[model samples]
Target: MDQSYKKIEKLKGEKLIEKLFSEGKSVVAYPLRLVYLKTNFDAPVKIKAGVSVSKRNFKKAVDRNRIKRLMREAYRLNKSNYFNNIPDQYAFMILYIGKTKTDFETVTKKMNTLMDAFLKQQSLPKP
Candidate 1:
């Protein structure tokens, strides 16, 4: 399990992002929200993920960028544990919804909780 977050694993494209928000399901854990959509990719990867920090909340590019960086690092460190066994490819957008700044420890803890919630939701029988 490679812990590095490579450029190829970064989610991109405007249309795909729009579709993800409009059609995807989300799981929230405090400041973090994981919005996921099952989708096929030409690339040979199990997941493509992106992180976001709201400009409205942070009001500064530096603040937003820092939060995004924290979120991405948390995801990169924790993803393999949660996603390694899954066979389907997914697109994930992790949004930081809190108003204040947070530390890496808090982000990592919340990320673990968020991923647990996501996996629990995934295992449920769909109606």
Candidate 2:
């Protein structure tokens, strides 16, 4: 599978983002929270994902940007293993909820845990 995160796979559009947060369900693994929605897209990609870091927590744009970059890299490296078999298209927003700065190893470990939780949640039957 391709490991590159291309522009087409980046989630965009204000309306879609609004709908995702308003209607999507979430899976949390400590500092990382993944809010996801199952939806169709014009693009052919199986998943569209975006990453965010809270301005309130980081205070500086430099800090927030670094965290977002780390989160995105972690997601890019891990997503293929967890999501390759999923049949439905999904939109995902990954938010960094921690207050302090973090390292790449920590981010990658948490990302793996988060993806595992997400897959487990997705496999459960609805009530």
Candidate 3:
């Protein structure tokens, strides 16, 4: 796997986003929360991710963009940790939920923890 966040790996399109929100399940590790849903969209990669920051918390575009940048970089670097074991395709939305800005180290640490939680979640049989 390339392990890079390519344009094709970006989760977009109106219909797809709507379906994800409506059908996805979520896992959280403070400052970050991941909502993911199994996808049927044709694609080269097994996963596609979207990052978000609350507009209410970060009113400036710059602030939101900065946080998203950090989140993406963290995910990109550590994605391989659980990427190979994903048995199926999934679209993911990662949300930043902190009331204040946090450093890259904190975000990266939380991102790893979040992915671990997600992998563990996927391992258990669905109810």
Candidate 4:
């Protein structure tokens, strides 16, 4: 099966985005915060994900776009490290929370940190 991620797989819509932010629990790992919800879809891969950067932190559209681009790139390259860390079928959102624009190298490092945190979260004993 082709595993290339297409944009359509991304979680969108006002209501869904709201759920990820409010209803879903969050875990912070420096540049990114993982907001996740277990999904009804049968696939083992993440059904959808959204990446966001705060405009309040980055006043310029170019800087915001640049950071968003780097976040997406990091997700694209390192997504495999996290897909199995989550539940078999789930949708996730990783929000950028840093106050400054960052280079791709920094974004990628943050992605790795987030994924490591995810693994730690995954291994915790359930109540």
Candidate 5:
């Protein structure tokens, strides 16, 4: 409950990462796409997150790293918006899809919208 992004909050391990992409449900808000799966893993926290930027869009490693850092910061700040509402544990991967670099303000707004959308989605009964 520190509200900080600690090592435990970061998603890792090749198998776990692969499972998240293969089985997770996704939500998108412009520059950001979130893929998440509910799990029963025995972890200390309720959520784990990973951020990524496609090399196809930003060829430079520095650009990709910058975008990912921005994304992680946004998520870390707004995560509790949806995190507090969910009872189950989850793993998430956030992907950057914009063709060009976006400002922090834009990414922050979109990240809030994305988490809000996720909260709304969870309230609906699955078909």
Candidate 6:
């Protein structure tokens, strides 16, 4: 099985990003902002994705990279569960908004917790 989460197929254009956010739904988890604009595809598959960490919080490149990596990993492991039940497609962004650096495990736990709570609140179909 291919376990790849490549970026080439993910939407990265500024226009698309703007439109997705403009037309989609948003859920803020304080330090984690999830803006999702679902698509009209008949099948279940996430087309594109992106991650961003706040420079205002941690100015160091290493710290930013670490946080981004943690978020990506959490998404990679748990995204399929979120994608399976949704009726439409999604173009989304995960934004980190915090004042201090965090460990990977802590971030992952928080991300997973936030996702579960959001999905439950949305009443998205369960898998």
lDDT of 2 by residue, 1-127 (tens): 4788999999999999999999999999989999999999998888999999988888899999999999999999887787777888999999999999999999999998888888888893222
Q: Give candidate 4's whole-model lDDT.
A: 0.73
| Model 4 misplaced regions, further than 4 Å | 1-3, 42-45, 84-87, 124-127
Model 3 scores a C-alpha lDDT of 0.89
Off by over 4 Å in 3: 124-127
Task: Mark the regions of model 2 whose C-alpha exceeds 4 Å error after superposition.
Answer: 124-127
Q: RMSD to the native, candidate 2?
A: 3.0
* RMSD (Å) of each candidate, 1 decimal: 3.0, 3.0, 2.9, 3.6, 3.0, 2.8
lDDT of 3 by residue, 1-127 (tens): 5668999999999888998889899999998999999877688788899999999999999999999999999999888767865668989999999989988999999998898888888893221
Q: Summarize candidate 5's per-residue lDDT along 59-94 as a digit string, tens digits.
A: 999999999989988888877555764678888899
Which pairs of residues collide in candidate 5? none
lDDT of each: 0.91, 0.90, 0.89, 0.73, 0.84, 0.72
For all predicted structures, in order, the TM-scores are 0.95, 0.95, 0.93, 0.82, 0.92, 0.80
lDDT accuracy of residue 101 in candidate 6: 77
* Residues 34-99 of candidate 4: C-alpha lDDT, one tens digit per residue: 887765643344557778888889889998888888887888777765564344555678888988
Per-residue lDDT over 1-127 for candidate 1, one digit per residue giving the tens place of the 0 to 100 score? 4898998899999999999999999999998999999999999889999999888898989999998899989999988788888868999999999999999999999999998998888893211
Ranking by lDDT: 1, 2, 3, 5, 4, 6
**What tens digits encode model 6's per-residue C-alpha lDDT throughout 1-127?**
1335665535578877898878978777667887777664333354467888888888998999988998888877777766655655667788888888777777777777767766776787554
TM value for model 5: 0.92
- The TM-score of candidate 6 is 0.80
Cα distance off (Å), candidate 2, residue 38:
0.4
